[model samples]
Target chain A: MSLDFLAGFTIFMLALIMVVSMVPGLLAGLESSGIDYDAVAYRTGVILVEDPGWPVYPPWEMNDEVHKDEIERIGLAVSKDTPNILLSTKVETFFNDSFFTPDDYRNLAIFGDIPYSYHFSLRSLDGVTYNEETGDPLPPGYGYIRRVVKIKEPGVAVINGTTFAPQYTSLSSNQEFIVRLDFGQLLDPSVGAAYRIDPRTEPVNVTITNFGAYLNMTEPSTNATLRTVTFWKKDPTRPIPQFTRIPFAYGTTDSSLYTLTIDGNPYDLTPDTKVFDNDNISLVLKPAATSLFTLDQNSILDIRFNFGDTPSQTNITGIHHYDYNSTNVTLPDLQTGVLEVAVW
Target chain B: MVNDAGQLYTMEGVAAGVIMLLTVYIVISTTSIYTPGDTHIPDMQLEQLGSDVLAMMDTPDTNGTKSALETFVNADDDAGFESMFLSYCNAKASGAADDLHMSANVTYRDGNLIKEHQFLAPDNTWTGRESAVRVTRWVQLDSQPGRTTYAGARAQAVLVEVLLWRA
Candidate 1:
């Protein structure tokens, strides 16, 4: 070999060694970005599926537009004890983009150092109950995580005409039907939140079916006039406990607060519509209206339905206690759903 | 000097070649090329999904009712277990269901021996090469008659192990 060959080889070897040592550091830096994305996605998934947001008693979802800043986190799970089980009310509110801006989701759910564009979607396996999506369209390369969950929906109390006719209908001059909700019993600590009938958070659904059974038989009346529906509350904790009429805008038909349907026609709480014997009545009192009642756990709420006619066209005059009895209220099964979270 | 410089030059050349070869070898081994799949992100996602599905199945819709998992396991209903597990794991938020396969086993203590019984057999999708994740849950069983696989008349705790893989 020539004498110069040794000098050239030595220079090449030293340069190669320097480059090789630096390669590892470069690769590690690149690898971290990929790993961090996946880690963030996993963390977000766990937070949403396994946690019940802060201030769980009143629930974070109950915060109105004024108190929105008080909400620290937003979770869909029913409670911390029941992971992968979501509350339908929380799910509904969380996906309401108008109520929760994209910044809310980033600050509450993602909690990453740098802002990340996120996409969240939830779909029920049955394909009808829930199909909610919020956030931007997905990009090709993004961190993703999917969770299997069950959604707990609010139960509905159905007052079957045939079953309650004998108990409620009577030959009295007054035609009044009352559905009593005992908050003390309904919010018992023993019952899990997943199954508890919480009037404060869930909608109070009362449906009266088979109206023909309660019509006046002697007068051969084909229909009865539903004069007004009023809400009354009694606080047993108070020194003098008695049912008093709750002040509300009964004439204003606000679908956001409550929905009163008679014979399949939507009306306000003061629906004076004449119901045919074969018709049905459904009253859905949303949580927004319930929160306005200034009620506590000990308060007893009564939904009074007054039917007015000259000779009492209907004889539905008894208080139906809305308790845990399966006969009165039917709790639907937990619906299966899938939730996906992606971060980029 | 009897041309001893040639021997020294050959020695230098060999040393340089060895040094170059060693440097290349160290660099190649130290700097690993990690593909996206090598990160095991899919495995982590699959495992988490499997565990969540099992936990949700074990929770009853109502307070006093038996969970779907307990009922199926107690009755030795393998078919029901397989279908429910697949339905939960394969469900996607895009309205399109994914294709996932699973097999399960029940591990129980009989006397002093730990025994494993196959609860659900793998379907035709099993090729033995797919990457799979294992998730387990503990189930309490009341004293009952001896069944096909598990034989016990006393209350005991058993572990339900499931192997999940994307098809």
Candidate 2:
């Protein structure tokens, strides 16, 4: 009965007179401010944001096999199991066109000296080299032959030990050469960058003072012959991969069997996952993580993740930044469903 | 007795205030239409900007390497990093003559980069809570004749740094 909605109030009347008349100008002003009003509002409107801190790399770095803070060694060691004089081929034996990197080509064009010429030669050519005793055809003038071998045990590595290079005779090429590089050695102590070898105290610090070379195969007889390529790790610091963290997540139902992989091995978590204790649950890694995966620098411990009513799979993400610094393992964030993982 | 001019002045003041109040109300109402979905930039500007700069960096497609840096920035709010690291290499493909102004640095916390600092440079410095990395980015410049250019003078020996750990 009071005149609130119908006749309206005194303030309403005042606004009608002022606001109705000023509407066009207000609209025009609003149209001119070109600001991201939404962003401003959401930013200004928010009360608080939540950030949960999680230790990122514990599971991956927990391996006793890890070799850290010091250099480790890798390569075919000059010991009992180290390969010796395996077969190798010339990778650089070519025809008329030889394209080199700016620095390499520049040195040759200016000084005509190839002290740094990228080439390799045969250390053991018995198979391809025509041994007069066997009366086999001599290695074709401009070609190569190669072979591959695996280490029976872990030790220090050198190229002269396990690898062998096939012989080749120079053909129409202007120059033919082979440059020996210790491609097998993974670490050098002088520079102290760090190298490692696993299966021998996890990883022994070492460096690559020498790297295997690109053997020249340009022979005088074979201008275009069949090519055999066998490439490998130049003296590489080797380590046996070890386990790091065992990531496991579970559901509280009868269907709660989850699978988590640590290193390359798998453990049944039915015992480890289901605990009736009301206290805080901590996952303990077994066998202690070590830097066992040093043999192949690119090698890593594969972790398979499976959890919940659905298929739970997680892959280790790389925790590295520019300047080539990498954590070597990626720890997962449980709240975000990312797990801590490592590569041996 | 109030003079006529004084009365007029008072009226003008009242009118100005009322006008301002009305304008503010209208502005708030108009902007409220945008506060939710946030769909305003022209199609794919963010994506285009991001990919364009990433391509210029010549970062690899693999999970890490330069791609990691790009991915890390993607986690930031769209506008949060727009003027900072996002514009670092916006025009890298446009042969050397383009002028681009950008700087990059690491963000640190507790005396360490929030993310580990990995890219290499000649000189690095850190003092207590604050540090700046010199990320060498591109800047347009006056050209010089007969001089061989490496990555062109468009790039200057500048710096890229960030703040992270505070001890």
Candidate 3:
């Protein structure tokens, strides 16, 4: 009987030892290691603000749904040179929850062994909500960081009737209004990246107002038929500089790339459309289209607006240089914003 | 004899139980309960926020104009600098501002000695014991004319140190 009791007792002792050995492992969840949450938050802030992020060429922000997997990191700053100055496109992409999954944010942004829940928010000083959140509801005790940032808004070239009326009527009815973007002057190294007009990333806006003033009023009707708008690129670095029409998928209307609005109605650049005078002609060329153009810093991008009618509709002509002429283009001042990141 | 043997077994069991209990007690006690000192997370967070606000202020909004930080530091406008810094730190996405207090000092090298000018004084509620974080920025000044705090009037780089804490 004693021997049997001893065997049972030994078994119980062994079992107890085993349970004791596993206690630390079980308690591991209860007591986390000295990994600082705030340190993780600070690191994340630095990643988003200072670094330009992975795949600098093409930029991670350019990745679409299909190419989403290729993007390793999401950074908002325009470039490493301009810290705390975020690019609007990058900001949009980073906050787009539909494009990026939670796992993607975990792996790409708050990289840690243990997956962390995060809340990121950016509010512009102009009271615009650029982005609100990227994750679940923030818990009580979470790693938090707040950064003050300035957002570099895209510049618009406004060619009103007052500024270009004389030049428009100067040439006879070939009917082409050329708005030239000198990339060399726009991308001058002396100009800081925060304020530089980089066509590769920023949308090019050309808004012509008071169209009636430029119309062929000499013709009985004040309305003019806009034939087709075409993009032409010329590389000044080449020995022979000549403008060549850019080959684009003009057949399909990609509003993401470029949008042409005549009096507020969207229309395809190709084919014939009637442009009424006393209306607005706004053309916004998105960065995606600019990237597809394959133009470099020395290349001059011409946005030619062609008007066609049997007797020639409009007398608008000559190239309008979209430079720092404040009267021609209105560059909005950089607005301040606050970006907060919380991780747990 | 059987009774004696039963008594010995019971005593042995009691001894074993005591040994097991002691082992667990020692193990649990020795397992270090991590103190906050090991991870200065709060301090780190505060430092980063302060630094970011200062750095952002130093950055020019456009290519041509002077930075807000330079203008504030050059003019030695304590109230202006304090208000700006607080606003930048306090403004939140929720449209509600945070409650953060700060004191600032400008440090510049004056010949052989390093001089510190009291840029901003703490408010009346400030106590010496609050856990505060220090953040600094380097501001280059064209000249120190009409300022008796620092020695040389020539162009010099000054360090703007700000001590920030939560109220």
In terms of lDDT, the best-performing candidate is 1
In order, the TM-score of chain B in each prediction is 0.78, 0.23, 0.79
True contacts kept of each: 0.40, 0.00, 0.35
- Writing each residue's lDDT as its tens digit, candidate 2 over A136-221 gives 13322211111111111112211121122112122222221212112123222221111122221221111111112111222111
lDDT tens readout by residue for model 2, B1-167: 64555445445545555665777687768776754333332112233333333333323222223333343432322244433233342222112312223323433232232332333222233343232222232222233453223222232221224322112
The C-alpha interface RMSD of every prediction is: 5.4, 20.9, 5.1
Q: Over the stretch B2-75, how does candidate 1's per-residue lDDT look in tens digits?
A: 56664565566556666766776686565555444435888999999999899988988776898999889888
In model 3, the Cα lDDT at residue A205 comes to 95
lDDT of 1 by residue, A130-241 (tens): 9999999998768889999999998898998988899888887489999999999999989887888888878899999999889998888999999999999999999999
lDDT of 3 by residue, A1-344 (tens): 57646855775586578658868764663334334576677788888887778878788887778888888887888899878888887888888889888888888888878988888888876566464567788777677778888888888988888768887775365888899999999998888888888888888999988887787766756878877889999999999999999998865678889898888888888747777777888999988899899988899999999888878767777788877777767788877888888888
Candidate whose DockQ is highest: 3
Off by over 4 Å in 2: A1-344, B1-52, B61-136, B139-167
DockQ score of each predicted structure, in the order shown: 0.34, 0.04, 0.39
Identify the candidate with maximal TM-score: 1
TM-score of each: 0.86, 0.20, 0.85
